[model samples]
Target: MDEVEVVVAHSERATLRVGDVFLKVDGDRARAGVEARAMALAPVPTPEVLWHRPPVLAIAALPGRALAQLGRPSTASPAAWAAAGAAIRTLHDAPLPPWPGRSADDLAAALDVECAWLVADGVLPRDLVARNRRIAEAALRPWTPVFVHGDLQPSHVFVEGERVTGVIDWSEAARGDALFDLALLTLGHREHLGDVLAGYGTGPDLDRDVIRGWWVLRSLLTVRWLAEHGFDPAAPGCEIDVLRARL
Candidate 1:
């Protein structure tokens, strides 16, 4: 009897700290559309630290499967992928404050916060983030700024036929480097990269250096997170490969 609480994680696989709460938590499962899901979490209001605790009741599992569970790649068509990109762009350039937009100031600020975290953990260099800041700023220098999905991947996309059913998951949402989302497709569906970006009106001429740099950032930060929990992400060769290609 292993412990579990959620049955159906739903279209949007959000993090939840459900069940009986301690003053250290924010009620049950910090989410909507879920009930009786035991999500072990840390102090709400701010995720300082966390621990997993089983709940007395389990939220009824939803009637669906995660793309990861299917053991197959996404069925989202080129058109659907492009459509998601368009929608995510809107989220990026949102006029509301408390977020980043497609602007030099926005890019620098976002990079500063993210890079500082990586540097503090000794996973990357200060100059690395600085270089990215410059690239993102320049990439948009000639074009109208459009915010892009901070994180984009097959798993974050759900489709039914040529239509995109859902584009969930916003934890990494940000407002810079729209092309970075396309880069995700390159890694996930390299063969379709041309088609995917083409639908975005750019036609497959992605900036190799900048996209590769962002990939490196993902690898570095992800590997560091894994290492903190006593797991090594199969050496750093994958990261080195991307970096070398850019040189």
Candidate 2:
């Protein structure tokens, strides 16, 4: 029998790997349903859904390794990073999903709440949080909705050589800002932003400041959640460092 390997485990969800299959156990069955639906709708490659029952969805593993991991330098080549960007562009260009994403007001409110908690709890320095909050303001504006993977983290993207194989983790999938996906993809891997933009083909139209804002916003919003979920957001090159970089 193949030994079960825990890929990720948190209060909201957990993923376990048994041989070539991944079983995602989510507390919210609706999110699982959305993940499966998003994977089906995504034009890019996604893991084949073997079966889905409430709380547990089984999927076959993809062909290649993750594009990168947070807090670790990526070993993927520039071309591979570009490939990821291309894949993301394709997804964004797809037809919008049925559901809506968080609005600017909602995001701003959440940011306000999180920032106050961070300061009141002494989780991070007020100056650091304040500066990043200022930077994050740029992203809390109206955007043309696109078919976003929502949580397009580097680790969700998989590649083989210079080719993108598949992107995983679609629970956060929704119609949102295209830059949010781009920002998340290059969060800790800023060195690859040029390569990604090259493939995304945004040329002079890309708003780099907005992307920068998202980096700060995403980091700030996720830090406490990460800590609560048993993740070290303060690790080098991770969420805290990303926020600190804005300082």
Candidate 3:
């Protein structure tokens, strides 16, 4: 019997790889439904959905490895990064999904609550958190929502040579700010930002400040989550470094 390799196991979801198939077991059946629906609607490359049975969905593994992983330097060429950018652009150009994403006011309210917790818990320096909080607020302004991957982490992007072979994890897919996806692709991978932008053909319409703001917001929001999940966001070249760059 082939070993069932655990790809990721968290409280909300778990992924197991057996042979060429990945079985995603989500705690929330609704989330699994969203992922399946998003994959069906996405025009860009995505893993083939083999089958679905309630909380577990089976998908065929993509041909190539992930573009990059968190807390590690990407060996992929600039061209590969650019290809990812192009893939993201294609996704953003698609028609918006039926469901809406979080609103600006909701995000602002959540950020305020999270910031207060960080300060009270002393998870980060109050001044540092305050500065990043201020910067993050720039993203809370109005934006014309478009189709977004929701979670566009480097590890979710599969690349073969200079081409983006596939993208995975679509539960968060929804209509949201386009810059959010751009910021996610470049987060913690600042060196590759220029290359990605080149492929994306980011223009004057692109809000660079908002993109930067999302970076800070994402990092701040995820630190506690990562810590609780047995991952360290404060490690060198990780989320903390991204936040520190603002200083």
* Among all candidates shown, the one with the greatest lDDT: 2
Tell me the alpha-carbon RMSD of every candidate. Answer: 9.8, 0.9, 1.0
Residue 213 lDDT, candidate 1, scale 0-100: 50
TM-score of each: 0.48, 0.98, 0.97
What tens digits encode model 2's per-residue C-alpha lDDT throughout 1-247? Answer: 9999999999999999999999999999999999999999999999999999988999999998999999999999999999999999899889999988888889999999999999999999999889899999999887888999999998999999999989999999998989999999999999999999888987443799999999999998988899999999999999988988886
Q: Give the better candidate number (1 or 3) by lDDT.
A: 3
Query: Against the true structure, whose TM-score is highest?
Result: 2
lDDT of each: 0.43, 0.93, 0.90
Stretches > 4 Å off in candidate 3 = none
Model 3's number of clashes is 0
Residue pairs with backbone overlap in model 1: 7-61, 8-61, 8-62, 17-29, 18-29, 36-59
lDDT of 1 by residue, 65-135 (tens): 22221124555567666654444434434542234434545544655565677678666566754564454
* True lDDT of residue 78, candidate 3: 99
